[model samples]
Target: MDVHGTVAPGFEAVRDVFAGIVAHARGGAAFSVVRRGETVVELWGGLADPDAGTPWERNTLCVLFSGTKGVVAAVVAALDVLDPEAPVRAYWPEFTAEATVGQVLSHTAGLPFVDAEHDLLDTAVCAAMLARQSPLWTPGSRVAYHPLTYGYLVAELLRRTTGRGAGALVREVLARPHDLDLHLGTPPELDARVARLVRAPDYRISTFLDDPERRRIVERMYAGLLDSDELVNSARYRRAELAAASATGTALSMATLYDLLAAGHVAQQAALARASRTWSEGVDALNDRPLRFGLGFELADPIGTYGPAEVAFGHSGAGGGRHGAWPQAQLGFSFVTNELRAEDTDTRAATLLATLYDAL
Candidate 1:
């Protein structure tokens, strides 16, 4: 497999590792890294669309899935609206829940899944549903990954405070000024650049679970949500604002965004720090793994999802896409793919991360 891209001096090993992974992988992927705000490696290979015979170009965009949460968290942190201790009702009067903004950011707010059948694009309807629903657990009592509802809550809070939607605010405050290509709500004209997601051949939630009861519970928990891969790749879903999941962009853009946050703009840096601190740590009920979470970002785990640094923080999307920044190393990295895989036990991203850290 031939990879097309460049690596800065002394970073050839990173490129080699990426090339090896793409060479053997079933689908295309892009990996990028930035050090001290300079791009050190930008590489991509394989098929963006195997069926269409499209090569994975540097500009190819892929869905970020939950990785979108990290960008949202950074935006919120930069705004400084999260008071860690203040009740969320303080900002959105309609929100009757007693959870704090920090709790919502930290995934401790119990509104993980909105039970109502309201349209997600209808912010008012979704916000109303969120307001009416009771949390799965007492606010801030435990950590359960809010797979889809997180972005809605964040967007609602932003809408009430900033007089703009989360997607618009993110573009205005971060993407536009930094020239990052990331988007919470992708526009139609850019649709051609988005890559089609190819589901892993052997994905099954039950396969990862050993206990019958646990498998049953996990299956039921996810049964009601919309089919995520299909929804995300659809034109309507891509065009709408699903802030937690629908973000589409290149790996370079995601890495560059992290680079900007790492550059130490007082507010952005402080926000990044707040988001990277371990706000919660325990076995995640959803994935059934010992997980750690900062404000909105997932902290580096023993699983190596965010690489080897205990201080690294970022988000991983549904498939194999991983992006984060290691503040200790002054490095930001992104790995994105069109191949959607089961999150449990998939070590491709982890392997590349280990190689990158070793090379560094």
Candidate 2:
């Protein structure tokens, strides 16, 4: 594979690791790193459209899936509008009166899954549906990953507080000022730059099942959610405002956003520190693993996806996208690919992360 990009001096090892990974990837991928606000490495390789034989150009955009969570969280934190301890109902009267913003960000809010019939694009209808439902468990007692509803809740809050769409707020606050190319919804003009995602041949939920009990729990937890790969990759899905997922951008844009946050103003840094603190840690009810989460970011765990640096904070997408920053090392990293694989025990991203850290 011919990797096309550059690395700052003394970072050749990082580029080598990126090249090796891209060489083996079934589809195209991009990797980037920023150290102390400087772009130290940026590289991409492979075929963006494997079927069409299109090259993965520097401008190719890939869906970030749940990695969108980190960006959403950063926008909210930077605005510093909501008091973490305040009840979400205080801001959005449609939400359950007892659930707090902190609980919502930490995934302890009982509103995880929504009705299968709920129209995700209709914000008013979706908000009404969530408002009518009761909590599955007492709010903030246990942790459950809110796969899709998280973005809705947070975006609704933003709408009520800022009188602007979540995407608009994110662009004005983070992307515009930083010159990042990320987007909550891909505009029509940039649609051609989107890469085609290729699902792994053997990928399935059963690949992560340990026993029947865990499988049963996972199935129940994931009920009413859209698990079909076809729906996720559709044009309708890309154009919709699904904040928890559906973010599209290049690896450089993702890395640049994280780098800015990692080296942001005092208030922004303090907000992120509070958000990244250990709000929940233990075996998660939905995923059935020892997962750890801060406000909205997943913390690095011993058996975690983003390596073992405890201070590292970011969110991993369902397939192969990973974005985070290591405050201790002053490093911001992002890995994005069009190859969709089961995320449960995948170590490809982690291997690259470890190699990057070692090179430093």
Candidate 3:
């Protein structure tokens, strides 16, 4: 299915994108792109299911996992947007963790993972635990991906000050202002637009379940974290805010929203400018995980094989659910798919990146 659309008179950029999608589809993946605040490519041609019955669709929504943290950070950035001096702790008093707002924004707060032994569904209690949690390293000593913790920390802080849940605040203050449809929790009205998530071939491992050591690691990673995915799909989880990972929306909205944020339109750019310094200057190749991180954002690593050298800021989901906003070119790019594949790893996202950079 071709979700391709052009906003400008030129067609070459769009054509290249289509070609890239064709490449991905033949190889069992999907691709999309946006340029200058307009979607130029929304191409999808792959199987969303094993039997190949449901074709990959443009509206597919999948678990972004850590990638969704960027969005949550952006929402927290709203506070800095409105009031840069407002102590982050002022919003979240529990944030007395030996770090400052700048450190958190820069991903040096030293709170990388939650207790990992607790349930995650409980946001308030878990967030309070983080406030008093010990620092993994001296605050701001080094950069590491705060994969599961950043979102909860930011949400708790935002909630303390704003008196509104992070999900609602994001919708009221940010999304509504920009007219973007990106949402943290899936609203009932948007249910029809949600594409059913298609599980990838290697998503579930009977081995991980049966393996003791692996289970121990998994348990620690989200000790208190709730089984949110299962909850979000339920009516209760939809109403309940799971800002860390339950965000559900299209790639189009995600790109467009971030483009506006990066371009410094709705709020002041000065606030985010300070944190814009590249956090992970180069790949932490030794760190085991291959992801590249920036201040509350991410750049596709050359080694991971995703995003562009000029990647302004974007987050990606496993199995090709990706979105990015290009500030340099005033471009907003988004891509989504129900088709999940095991081979479309960090390297393949890079192949998509090359196609996009060439289009530019």
Candidate 4:
């Protein structure tokens, strides 16, 4: 594959690693890294839309998937509006669960699956249904990955506090000020720039149905949403404000967002530190993985593959998008791809990160 983009002096290894991954991957991907507020590496390659022959450009945008959590988390932490200890009901008066703002952000609130029938885009109805439902476990007592529900819950809190949706808040507070291309809702003009996702070759619902309880929980959280390519690729899905996983942007934009947050406003930096502190870690029974979370950010595991520094924080998408910052190193990096891959076996991001740190 002919990779495009530049690497600063001494960072050619990152380009080499990215080129190797793109050579083996079906779809295109981009990676960018920022150190001490300067961009060190920017690279992209392969086909953005394999069928139509669209080349992946520097600004090509792909769905961030769950990596959107980090974008939303950055905005939330930057705004520094919500009191972490305050009950969610304090802001949204109708919230029935006893989860504090911090608990909700940290995925410690056990309201993962909403048991009501409602349209996914109907934010009002969905939020109301979630509000009325009780948590499956005591809030803050254990960690359960909320998956789709986390976005809605956080969006409602953002709505109540800022009178704006996650997308709008992100646009006004993060994108505009920082001049980043990140967005929750893709504008009509940028639709052409959005890359079509290549479905995972081995993805099958049966793969996750091995355990009965896991099946039940997984189905409730991702049954229709994960399976429907039509729904995910539709215009409505791109336009609607689904904050949990609907974010779209290039690797540089994501890296820049993380970079700015690491060195920008005092409140934002403080919030990032607080949110990046280990909140929960271990085998998450719901996702059935040894996952860990800070507030809304994913932290580096004991192995530190997420980043070389233990203080590295960011989020990864369901497939192969990884974006985060090594705060102590004052470095931010992102690897985004349209090709879906099982997280367990995907080594693209880890390899690129390893090369990046080594180059540094």
Candidate 5:
């Protein structure tokens, strides 16, 4: 568990809070921190596979749902480094919305979901469907978590603009630049290493469906769909580039990414910076009601939305998985695990972060 040495410039309370989560979870995890583009902490503990008894190695990969969206957004940032006038419609004319290229990147596109409800998990089918849909809200008019649609929109836009999937483009752009092991789609060779999601005992769609507005929002967020057990633990999902959610990688890799981002080493894309800067921050009744987002990253507005807001920003995945955030003192702090706890977004992720704020 203590493979990596402890980092300082933090409170003892931070160490205790970290230890507390490790003790509570029953799976393997890795937590790392980088300050000003330098690593200060790299820690791992527990088992990678409780069933097979495999120790959680330093290379263990976890599925970071919405966190992966940040990875995809990084591609746009990379593109923006090269061109600022490039329109989202330039890449995806279908997206020639009132929303500027800046609006889409900022989660203001309002096309939070596919126009209608369907099983968008199948990437190819979903991609085809997305090509023909219209915007949900005027781009930049309001904020709504793009939820499942973010992946389809970004990936398609990337492909249309650059003639390459965001996954491939990301690899050519930032991933390779930083030596990150993150993958938009799971390489077939790594099929065996991917951990099956572990759902909570009481996780049920009925619990969420009983509410009308919650249903509407979730439906729009998920390609106009619903959450399901099948959606959580499927190999088919492994290769998907779920733009807003479903990015797969390790804590170490994600931390490395944030480290670069925090240092303002963001790609030389001016448009990407402007787009990211254009994203709405602060308390929005809808977006922050579930999770607060800024451009491709989640704002660590602890006092307002979920966690601390001392320059902290990153995304958390479904089922207790997480990665990245630049606190006041650090650029990247990662908390990744294979536990796949039932309470993914709000419940446990918030708990882990709250604990981190207290301890760090």
Candidate 6:
């Protein structure tokens, strides 16, 4: 496969791994790594649009899915306005749950799924549903992933605190100054640069139907839009400010965001330390794995998602998109793709990550 970017000398192995994955991938992906404020690797390959034969350009923006969480979390950490221990109701009076701001960011607040049916695109409706619903468990009592609700709640709190949307904060606080191509609510003019998402040939939704609770959560969060290529590739989805999932950007831009964060260019060191502390740890029913969380970021786990860096912090998207920073290694990187795959079998990002660590 012909990859379209460059890597520093020692990072050739990382490029080889990416090329190997792209050779077999039907869709397109981009992987970039930054070491100590310098870009060590930037590579992209495959079809941005297989049907149209659009090449994945150096700036092709792909949906980051839940990787959006990490970006928004970075923005939240930078703002540093609300107290993490303060109840969310302090900011938004209508917020019923006693869950603290920290609990929501850490995924410990039990407002995982809203009971009533509503358009996820409609932020008002989703926020109202979340505010009305009671926590499945006492706030901060358990660690359950709030796949979509996390963003809605975060957006509301951010709005209440900053008098602006999360996307606005992202643009002002991170994108503009850092020259990043990332966006929580992508504008129409940049539509041409956005890569179209496609499901991999072997893609399959793991509906946890055997367990009623898990089944309900999975269906509510991902039943339609998450699995629908037509919907996700639409302009509406890209334009919506779905911070938990709908971020669109190139791998380099995501990596650059991490680079800045890692260098403390955006948030204070104290704030970053607080956000990186282990706030929650338990079996994540949503992914059916033992997981750890720090604020809005996913901490390094035994599986080595961040390439064996135990103190690494970042978030993974639904289908093989990984973006994070390894403080110990002074590295920030991202592997983003438009192809949706089952995480259990996907090794695209893992292989690239391992190769990157080995090279370092």
- Rank by lDDT, highest first: 6, 4, 2, 1, 5, 3
Put down candidate 5 lDDT per residue, 306-325, tens digits, no spaces: 35645566666655556665
Give one digit per residue, the lDDT tens place, for model 2 in 1-360.
679999998789878888887788778899999888788989999989888889899989998988999888888888888788999889887675488988888888888766546666665576677777788788889887887778888888888899988778768887887788988877888888999888787555535457787566555444423366566667877887777888898999888777777787423667877888888777666666667788788888767577766678888886778999888888789999988777665566887888787778
Task: Output the number of the lDDT-best candidate.
Answer: 6
* lDDT of model 6 at position 80: 90
Model 2 lDDT-worst window of ten:
217-226
Better of 1 and 5 by lDDT: 1
Clashing pairs in 2: none
Candidate lDDT values, in order: 0.79, 0.79, 0.57, 0.83, 0.62, 0.86
Model 1 lDDT per residue over 1-360, tens place: 679899888778777788887777677999999888888889999888877888888899988978889888778778886677778888888888889988888888888766756666565677778887788788888887777678888888888888888789779877888888888788999888888887777655423357676555554444333345566568887877777888888999888877667676524666667777889888765556777898888888876678777678889887788998888888788999987777775777887778777878
- The lDDT of model 2 is 0.79
TM accuracy, model 4:
0.95
Q: How good is model 5 by TM-score?
A: 0.81
TM-score for candidate 1, please give it: 0.93
Off by over 4 Å in 5: 1-15, 81-87, 116-119, 122-125, 203-210, 223-231, 269-278, 281-292, 302-306, 327-330, 342-360
> Per-residue CA lDDT of candidate 4, range 198-218, in tens?
777775442323678777877
lDDT string, candidate 3, 155-184, tens digits = 766666677787788788677887766677
Off by over 4 Å in 3: 1-32, 44-63, 81-91, 203-219, 222-240, 280-287, 290-292, 300-306, 340-348
- TM-score per candidate: 0.93, 0.93, 0.77, 0.95, 0.81, 0.97
Q: Which of the two candidates, 4 or 5, achieves a greater TM-score against the reference?
A: 4
The segments of candidate 2 whose C-alpha lies over 4 angstroms from its true place after superposition are: 205-229, 265-267
